[model samples]
Target chain A: MLGIDWNFAGCGCGVPQGKDVEVGMRGLLVKDFRFALQNKKMMVMLVVIEAVFLVMQGAGSASFVMGYMMMGCGMLVLATITTDEYNKSMAFLMTLPVRRADYALEKYVFSFLCNLVGFFLAVVPYCVLRPDRVADTLYLAVVIMAVMLMLQMVMLPAQLKYGGERGRMVLLGVFAGGVLMFTWGRKVWERALAGSEGLQEFAARMAEGIKGLDAAVAGIGAVLLCIVCFVISLSVSRRIMEKKEF
Target chain B: MLVKMENVEKRYGDFTLQCSLEVREGYITGLIGANGAGKSTAFKAILGLIHTDAGRVEVLGKNREDFTAADKEELGVVLAESSFNGMLTIKDTAAIMEALYRKFDKDYFYDKCARYGLPVEKPLKDFSTGMNAKFKLLAAMSHEARLLVLDEPTVGLDSVVRRELLDEMRRYMEKDGRAILISSHISSDLEGLCDDLYFIQDGRIQFHEDTDVILSDYAILKVNQKQYGEMDKQYIEYRMKEPFGYALLTKQKQFYLDNYPGIAVEKGNIDDVMLMMTRAEREKKL
Candidate 1:
């Protein structure tokens, strides 16, 4: 038995039978997860990079290493999109029984899972080495995850809209712009704060305000913002996919 | 109708594609066209890949705008390029497809791949062009789809593999109500496989006729200047001037054969009809 069921008993009109069976969003997530699993080399690379970061940074810099590793995982998520475009596999995917909305949803879920796993992997080493800092590490992980999600939210749609090469260039431009703004803004802030005692006092009060803020509320707000970004990004990607031609 | 496109329009800047066609149950419709004749665009519209500017597209009896994932499950598609991710092996692809498509038969897919000499463990990028083409067809066939839409499926395949693929298509049609819509630049492939052929040029369908009618009734008549000018042009669909004479294409071959016994009338294949119809000046009435 080769599992070749060539039964042609039904109306061969190609019309899907009564009440078209819809695969739920969960099925789409599973399919995307399976697709991601196929890239063994990328998974191995992610693990190796995280291990290297963990070892080099050591226990003292656990938060920094974890943040870097989580960000790395986020980059890997974007890589998957670029890889699909480069290989022109999106066309194949579009032909499948999955809707564009499902595809967009899958990307968001898959990328979130990947970043979560990366966060967990980073947390595991820190937990083993610096058990006392577990709570602090968890808080830092939430912040880092939020940042990663926001970055992904921006990058995903741009990649889907522009494709591999142009998308990478656009991502690079965004990164460069962020770095330039950070450096220039830091200098300007330092110059302003150095001359003005009032400004310095205000900055001190702002820092105190941030430190006094409720951690749980801040974490919840960050998560909510990430969710909002995810929804918006998913919608934009779906629209891009709808207009795309093979 | 299995698939229908009514006044489907897609425009990219100045290039506009306006097409209308149909694929009926148990029929194989061939869309024959030149390289950029909008065949792929029409396919994209039918599959709802690209948003059309205007017109209605219905697939499997449902308007394309309303087609759900389950509706798409009954339609198998193979594009001009190998759409498989290059990093994925056949095994991985089968897994992904099984997860995506509820009716996907993994064992049957593997069997078909094995029969086609496609290595199950190798990534698609490692496969040759012919192997990739065969693998795509095999994947499309493994799914028990009622409508199979193939675009340039046999382009890189050798004659033997092509014949085998065509035979497989014939076998696929054995189940009543199954239909296929295939597009190819190679007209000979369609000559033997297609039930009806639609000739497209410059984003418009020039003509559509049954393969039997095309083979039996259509012809290329070779005549000198004087004879071509003197002959009744009523039946001549198109005429192209050659170095030595004029090659005229007519739908009523028997009429020309009966009336002008001296004229050289050759039985028209899909290619001859496409060439003459595309390049020849259109008749005022048609």
Candidate 2:
């Protein structure tokens, strides 16, 4: 009578996936939070670590060094997750009436939650310690998210294909090497400017000009990048899983 | 019928498993095949664990791929390997499954655990292979499912445990509407429990018939080769003939029985049928 076709393909087996049928993310939210209920000890342990990290990074002024360390931790967690799914725990979960799409969505959303918690903790110290840099703290939040989102883009596909151990190793190596090279380039530029009187003044003027743009633009860019990566990853991973053999 | 696979075809690299099958309600159907013969692959496809390249799997008249959580709750599975998280105790796994499956039966879970002497407090990792299989069965049975899919459920269990598992499955079907699809290489179990048998070979269903029908229809006729040389090859599924004598499997056992009253018409089992079919299937390729 409601004209809702129980046989509707879009609802269960249709062009519009049933998993995407509603605004309600109860399924996603439930699984992301299931660890809290299923393993209370582990949840308590993670919460304690977050509080400790927040205290350590007070004034939330996270350095590039802090960013690198968090990325390493993220890589390690993703590795463990992928190994559990592929070699160890997958057969059991797959046998149940769980959908592949829901499974993939949980991985992406939960890992993002992990990064979100880490980023928030990193800035909480600065937000409370240095109220003046609250705005900077917020900006740091966006940048940390951008870096994590990019890492996810690399990890999800690799984990889905080759899986955890090797994928994380490659991602961490690539990221660390790339950042180190950039640091080397920056230090070389600093030495070049220090060696020349004219170049020093010119570099100072350029730096001032570059810093004038609104920090809000960085936030906007990071948010947009995250949205794009999340959407593309979800779609691509769905296709890969739909066609995957096991 | 509880489960039906129509013209199913699955190919993984060089391996292929093809068959059309149906499992009626109130009966246990044993999916018999050799190792690497695609029995597990077929069961996986039926459970929607692995997607078949072609064909449809229907459960309770609804296609398996179209199932929801509610639908899945009514269809239980006990894979060879336990699916419960290693860190979780029997209680922990039971609690999680209870939350996840709407029909999860708590009292039934405890009763079965107590009956089987499974330690609810023991971490699942500490259980032996036999104990693990029992717990998996307990979890599945707790669902009170209309259909149960078991993939080599008796793999590591001893003969006594294997019989106990089969007996439990049989008791579950006493309600007269439930069904089960059991895939195992153990032929004696098939003989003991299955109402119907499906023999798969080389990815194609070479033979599928009633258990009693096969038992009555086939016989190991021991006859002198000189006399058997003039017999019809069309009726012979297999004939191990030599200069001394011959042992043959004929579909028309009654015909041979009536014709050669003096010849031995020993009964063939589900295992003998499997051996003959798989052997003949391989000999065809050569």
Candidate 3:
């Protein structure tokens, strides 16, 4: 799915040839999807939560639903990594025709698909309810997707490093730490700017320099940054998988 | 050789495995050893599940580092304590295997599943220990792998199911260019199954011999202390102080029979060979 065509027939090779790396990765995705589906309670819970939000918030709930489902599905994919660890099955899975890199890459692809599914689920209902706001909803969905992807960039590696249960705690700690630092840093920035004319001029110039850029260029820059973050996250996860032993 | 390990070593605190072995095409090679004898460690090295601290491990004619995903498609592996995710149904496992292995035979897989009485819809966690073993074996074979590295695949299985699995392995070997490296604590299974056997103890290989040679040439000679002293020790390999007197292990069954007709010479099997190799003192002169 990530630039690898699923229709392998054109390659004129079958399992006997075993030349396709993508096929093994496809298998990993299927296994992960199967595991995700096994959590029927979570699936039902997502539906109920969406219905309740829609009823309570009306059309205003579209953004909330989008955020909730994206988080829900992304988390489900992340949890599959832990399921692979259960019964030491991760070792056995590694024995298959998939490389460590492919296994790591598959998680990212699966995560993106889960987020896409969540986006589609939220958008379809919102569009039906408020057809005139389709463009606005799409734009909001893109912004939310970017944020969710950035979160995954942090979360996936954390999950692989700390494991399933502990990884969640680690993610919480990181988020809490980031929030505290941001608040304190903002106060320090304002105080330093107030105390120094030089710093105030530098800060204004920095803001004027960013504001001078075209909106399209800024959007492209943000997208490029997100892609770079994703690639780095995938690399970190691959290293983790390579060093892991049964 | 389909799989080969030479002077391989894996150290875990006090236990370090220094082993060398090979699995040739068309041969079922048995890694015979007691628990913690490093059989699983050696298998893990060959399968690339764990890294070796030193020496070489080559599978499918390539060093593990050079072996790509395509190379792994030709090899199937079963670990001693792990299988497919327990949350999956047999059906789900089949689908995953089909995707993972290019040559996965779903029909043959389902046939084996039915033969082993495995319910396709049931979660693997719900399977009995023996059923799980059967499923693991079936999954490994269903892909038509050229080399199958199995670590204790028959554990938890009863005699009947064990025999059935052996027969399945036999059938698998009927095809040319296929081989299996299996480990187990059950001696009779290896005696009847492996073409050649490597006996390991305390992270080292004690002996490697043809299964037929172990069964035919090896013998355990029970003798009183006086008889033990008087009998020829030229063919003796190991000697243990039994309550009756001294129990001798020798590879020359005919030599003792010819020299002393009255001596008790019991034919050796895998168990006796392992028992002597691990517990009995080596006759250093031999």
Candidate 4:
């Protein structure tokens, strides 16, 4: 009987219940971290590349390093999922004490933690080389982090739903579609504006409106949007996991 | 009962598994069936690995669907076709187990690994099939789970290793609350280890009997055509047409022993029971 407290905090319904959930979550997190650690060679290679870029390009390469590391951190989550799913090992993993919901939550938490570390690690060159622009660098970094978080939100659910191989294909399709839409949308807007003064005036006003937007408010808006996406993605992932057969 | 599956049904494209079974506390229950006999399906249903099309699967007294993380903590499992990530070392697995289970016995795990010649630092991908099977079983038992749902836990191993694993299973059952629901193609293993047996044939539990009853009371009566025509058919659970004449499977061994002195009655084992229970109908005309 392992001295486990089987109380469930008096709630008998659904998963992610009681203190045991946290313990199981810790276990799940550790497993993923270990999985990530197994790619130590890749991690070191990335760091070496960033270091060379820093030495060659100096502080100008800070944002590049930041974006690179943030994405690398985010990719670790996918790698863990892929490893868990490798050779149908997800079936074996699900048999552990951790519930499916707990598994999803742990991935989300681990992703955020990894991205946080990436953020801090990536900003070191900027802090060292261009301390004067620290405030602006911090602001830009926050925005990039928000974008990275949204990417993560999209990624986690996709990986959970479609698994590793198909999930990557889906992600590629999504990015390609977004690029196409943006390109076609800009051409359509230009054509429409060229057709009328009234439309051009409206466009001018829209550009002015955008130019006048407050930085802090936009930052807050990005953060809020990331939060909303995070919530939605988390809910979707939980559903995918709960309904998953293995 | 630690696990109860009542008419639990699962359907693949062409295969449908309908099973009813129970694993009670302090007893080792063996599920004996040929390949594709729904043994794995039944275990998966009990573990909530797959969604059942109908009926109920209860584990540790809660419907499997309602098994919270805490509830699942009481279950240990080893799937026939899957195990831990191959990229992980045994040490990494041990660390993960220590985190995942409050009752995980790290010392016990290390001790077993040592005894079994498993290297702690080597990745699981480097291990042989027999080593992997041992590791999976050790991981399942490391958690001190009340119920173990094992599907072909002894599938790939030598006789000596298989014997050692079975011995470990017996040692695991020494605890008062522990129980196991194991399936194996090796009938000799189940016959010697299991408290009771369930014979599944094509997704249905065709026969269920205590292991003692199967070993002690069940018998296969070999008779010539003349003797077969004259012998009582009421006690025959299954009958197979042999090249010589007829091989009758009966639960009432004493009934035939008393009446048919001239007939040869062979003591029934799991392989005999499974062979007769699953394939006899197809082989026997009447």
Every candidate's fraction of true contacts kept comes to 0.43, 0.26, 0.74, 0.83
Decide which is better by lDDT, 1 or 3: 3
Please say which candidate is ahead in lDDT: 1 or 2: 1
**Model 2, runs deviating above 4 Å:** A1-80, A86-88, A116-146, A169-210, A213-221, B64-70, B227-235, B242-244, B280-286
Question: Which residue pairs of candidate 3 clash?
Answer: A15-B102
| Candidate 4 lDDT over residue span B140-240, tens digit each | 99888999888999988999999999999999999899899999989899999999988888889988889999999999999999999888899998888
Tens-digit per-residue lDDT, B1-286, candidate 1: 9999999898988778999999999999999888888888898888877888999999999888777777788988899864867877888778767766778898889888888889988878888999989988888988799999999999889999999999999999999989999998778889999999888888899899999999999999999988987889999888787887888889999999999999999999998988887777453222
TM-score for predicted model 3 compared with the true structure:
0.93
Please, what are the lDDT tens digits per residue for candidate 1 over residues A36-138?
Answer: 6665677677667667766887676766778877876667667667767656677777778766655666677778888888788778877877788888788
TM-score of 2: 0.78
Per-residue lDDT of model 2, residues B1-286, tens digit only: 8888998888878987787888998888888877777777887777776767788889877887776545665778887753766655787766666656667789989998988889998877788888888888878888778998888888788888888888888889898689988888788888788888887766776677777787778777778866676666567777564355866777788888777787777898887677666564455411
Every model's DockQ, to 2 decimals?
A: 0.30, 0.26, 0.48, 0.61
Ranking by DockQ: 4, 3, 1, 2
Report the number of the highest-TM-score candidate: 4
Cα error, residue A164 of model 1, in Å, equals 2.7
List chain B TM-scores, each candidate.
0.97, 0.92, 0.97, 0.97
Error of 1 at A181 (Å): 5.6
User: Which candidate number maximizes lDDT?
Assistant: 4
Flag regions of model 3 displaced more than 4 Å.
A1-19, A208-215, B282-286
Between prediction 3 and prediction 4, which has the larger DockQ? Answer: 4
Better of 1 and 2 by TM-score: 1
